[model samples]
Target: MNNTLKVSKYLFRDFKNALLIFYGIILAIAVLMAALFLNVISQESGNASFGGFGFSAFIFLFVSGLNCFKANFKFLQANNISRKRFYYANIITLLSISAFMALIDASMTKVLKLIMPYEDIVEQLYKNDLFFSSFIWSFALFTLAASAGWCITMLYYKCDKLMKTIISFAPVLLVILLVMLNNVTEGALGISIIKSLTVVLGFTNNNPYTAALSFLVATAGVLGLCYLLIRRIAIKD
Candidate 1:
């Protein structure tokens, strides 16, 4: 628990300045965009919905991945911290920050309702349950994304140049294969894989709860891989 506290404190201090600047820049841009959108479009008949989880997920992914690179990893290694502790601490930070962002995003609906008069996209889904369920849903998604991002960076960090190069092209290769397969054969292979995964993960189209559960498992797997990578990671790695 002390290690957890230490890691959290370290993260707070480590990224405080950058985080503030990033948030300020995002807020300023958002305000400008909202103002422009409001001025240009009539609110009464506006199909435009403002205030939903937009940049939070991507920001978490980017920030966490960036922070978990050589510098932080080396620092933790120098401190003689166990990989397990380090990983859990980062997980705590991930959940905490993600939840905070989710709360703010959810509150934006109320704030935007005063300015723009249309049913917000996120708010519509949580009409029956409101803040609690919505926050859980959003938090799960952002955490999963962040964990996946961290896992990817870890993969890169632990890899040699050749491996990194191969990994870099992996996404493009996957996409190309998908495209080629589609062209060559009218394939439900991808869809079948997805369906199989959903079944394995207990995800159901009608049940957001099940989807959230699926994401929880996915997040755990990603973060677990990240942890395993760090277990034997060297200082520079």
Candidate 2:
């Protein structure tokens, strides 16, 4: 088999085994949440609501992608694949999963709309001015999370257990620090800094192209750092 085909097959097999299991659990939780929220909406507004459940499901799938990446990385290494091929395969697999999950989310929203008598909730979701923006943000967040997982896996591959534990928690700590700063500054400093930086970079108008370019640059920089670290520090057993 050719290298691409080999990687593709390996990617598919691992994804089938791991992603499916995680997806099934997520689907079940989503359905249950939808059912429960439907009752609450019906009681409060005399109409069923599926929005909460749908949103929860979406969040679950986004979070689950990290676990999928971790599982796939271990499987690829066990199967004797090179780290480069493993990384490429992981990126491909993650994109495919994200696309599929997005489609599923859309489909569920449609189905919920059909079953529920409440047009108000559905209309709010479909017609909100920030709907598209929120969708794009969700996609960006997923990419960030997946990339973070890959980076953590690399750290684990390169470092001792103690080092891996510290490295793994670094992102969490950074997030906490950001939240604390935001709270302390009453959210002004962070927002001002981001806006100022965006304006300086000529991205203040929120052009989709510019935002996408920024995202690509940031993702590339992260992946590059991961590559360098893994190349230099990874233990080849």
Candidate 3:
């Protein structure tokens, strides 16, 4: 546990500056976007919707995957850090970041609401009216997306030239496959999958906990696979 904490501390310190800078930039962008929305209000328009959370989620996920997960491995290997300790630290760090991001997200919503009490343009797609619910689901998404990014990057590192080539085409192939499946079945597979997920998670799209629960489940699976792949991964020069 002590070692895990140490690992987590080290990982956090390593990226703290970069992460802060990134967030600072994002904050500036959000404020600008909020101002833009306000401008629309000045014109007596009715488009009080803010999808900044989408951008927030993507940044949190991809940045954590690349900087927090993938980059840390190099330093850990050089410092002779234990794989087990690093793994624990990874979980801790990811959860912390996810929680923090969720806080920022919810906070922004509140800030916008406070600044423009009558403005309904600052929209949050997550239908939860409560801050806690919003935070829970946001954390779920952040951690899950980061975990997925970690797994995908790990796979890239572990792949051969041929494997990398195959991976490059995997997305296209996947889309084609799904299209064919949809055509053959004459069913809306994507909608069906979403419905199934909503049912399994015991929450609706409007429910704050819906995707959050599913994300947790999927994150666990992805993290397990990541651990297996990275456990014996060689430290590159």
Per-residue lDDT tens digits of candidate 1, residues 1-237?
587779877866665676677668767866775786688766456676554434554565566656655676678778887777777788887777777766766566456556765343334543433656556666777788778877888888889999999999999999999878866776776777778767643344434455567778888888878878878876662
Question: How does each model score on lDDT?
Answer: 0.68, 0.57, 0.73
Better of 1 and 2 by TM-score: 1
Candidate 3 has its poorest 10 consecutive residues by lDDT at 117-126
Error of 2 at 58 (Å): 6.4
Error of 2 at 133 (Å): 7.3
Root-mean-square deviation (CA) per prediction: 3.4, 5.5, 3.1
Tens digit of per-residue lDDT, candidate 3, span 1-237 = 587898899877965886788778877877787687678664686545555554556576666676565568888877889777888788888888778877887677677666543221113443445767767777887888888877888888878889989998999999999989988878789779768976755455466576677779889998999899888887765
Candidates ranked, most accurate by lDDT first:
3, 1, 2
**Relative to the unseen true structure, what is the C-alpha lDDT of residue 63 in candidate 2, on a scale of 0 to 100?**
52
Give the per-residue lDDT of model 2 (tens digit) for 61-136.
Answer: 4455445544555566677667677666666665566555545555555555555542222234334323344344
Q: What TM-score should be assigned to candidate 3?
A: 0.85
Colliding pairs, model 3: 48-121, 49-121, 50-123
What is the alpha-carbon lDDT of model 3 when measured against the actual structure? 0.73
